[model samples]
Target: MLVTFDYFLKNLDLSNKNCLDVITQGQWLNVHPAALVFAAALAQKVGKENVIIDNTAGKSGLYIDRMGLYDWSKTESPYHYSRHEEAGRFVPVKQILTSNDQSKFITDLIPLLHLPPEKSQVIYYIMGELIRNVLEHSMSKDGAFVAAQYRPKSNVLSFGVCDTGVGLKKSLSYYHFPKDDVEALKLALMPGISGTSMSQSGTGDNAGAGLYIVKNLSKMTRNYFVIYSGTAMYKLLKYDKRIERPKIHSDPLDDRHSLVDKLPDFHGTLVGVDIALDDTSDFNALMEDIKVSYSKALRERKERRYKKVKFI
Candidate 1:
């Protein structure tokens, strides 16, 4: 059976079944990233040995080989380089990272990817913040899973982070209640929505700026930024040209930007980013732009609140 969202939901209750068959012999199983995350989490929950691939001699085998799916030797790294080899280019790898081992993982990845110092810093910041989010908010005992691939010819870098934990809706519900998954995702991306409650002194994730900053950076680089949690999915496509700030569209029908609802629900959250290696965006300037935009948004929200109060 193909490992799709439906398959995941169906197999979630792994009770009497000893081995959950993911793929048949010689059949190519197309697995979505979110499905991969779900499978990994399930495997950890049940015995990894209990998840079986019926046929291991075809495309499915090669896929497993490329991803190091079943390899669990402590001496072997969870990261797997792509089987397709290109001369003088880095082999894209899917790596599993834990909060405890992130530093070493980043250190090993930096040199292999051959990223410029500035670009490396950007990746570091993005990955660090996302991993931190998983550690702090995900509540997943198994930690986070990440995958990255860079096509040198196209100069496109694609990476994703996934965690099977309390999804965005549940996490944000601890702060402000959301009517649905879509609203919860929107609120999570806002500048000051966080599960972390304020202290007596009123200092906390006052900026709640992690996702906000990541979104701005993606826009500045004219890259793709996608987030999926629960049944909602949000995507920001790369713009044709640079803009001071990109508009966020909440309508799912918007082709340029997508905010979709009613997707098959995943157990946790997944964030995917795609950037061009030749992107010339200045990191500091992008950060400043985010701050300005956020400040403007805060002012507008306060003004609306004040106007409502006056009308009442």
Candidate 2:
């Protein structure tokens, strides 16, 4: 289990350091987009450069100790049932990428999925377009990406992406029509509107097609997308039960309340997404951990295995 706010309290100063980033599934689910903007901005203001973050060992600050500490001999990943002796429901998953490569990797994320090649590739392209907004725009120095899949006897896999970078408010303002975190979110869903006029950093999506495509795909595929920034938040769900009706605050306002007016007091951006997968015979097995272009995380993992440590 995750430690109490004690981690937050003890690392209050480190929050600016980007030293502690942890949250429950519910917490991540309920994260206010404004917080995403704030955290990314604040992390930047405090000079939180990308420190070596590793999730393979569940070493990322957000993982529970139980989800973390592991015996070396138990080498098989718990994600595989054959290796399931005793473990928690979570593990650390990490990635480090340069801005440009991260953008490319976004496009690459799709083929790794079990979905049909066409769906996965197009999804990667769409995701790539959305991520282009982040890597090209969010403006934070460091970032992190995590993905996990669970088979509750259902035909689906869940995944998410998070980062500490320039948030939607700043990026939105970059285009033109600015709004607070909440309003910007609504604006994102609207077509033919964007924060930018012709800026390259943003997806430059005035037609609102990029976001709309994501929203539409989420509905068609029965996937879910939760977007947050600058305290403005929105969620689109496509389950069999009931499709979510668009909120009344649909037409997003201008950048009057965007999060960038005060640079030093803000945190970076964070995006969480989930797509569905058909239930196969073994939906529980994960073929791989996140595969980013960066190799440093892998090199570090190999190095750690050789470091002989003596238990007291």
For candidate 2, write residues 1-312 as lDDT tens digits.
Answer: 011211222233333353423232332322222222223333334343432222343322223222221211122223332344222222223333565665555544444333455445444544465555555556655544443333335544444445566666676665655557655666565543455554212353334445645544444445555554544445553455453322212222321111222123224444544544441222212111111211333344356568688999
Task: Output the worst ten-in-a-row residue range by lDDT, candidate 1.
Answer: 1-10
Q: In candidate 1, what are the lDDT values of residues 1-312, reduced to their tens digit?
A: 111333334334434434445543355454434445445554554566666644444655555445444542112233345554422333223444465677766665556677667778677777777767877788887787765555678676666677778998888776578889888778777665666752211145444667767766776677777777888777776677745455542222332556767776666887776666576346676666666777676666567667443554
lDDT of 2: 0.41
CA shift of 161, model 1, Å: 1.0
Q: Which candidate has the top score in TM-score?
A: 1
Candidate 2 minimal-lDDT segment of 10 residues? 285-294
lDDT at position 34, candidate 1: 40
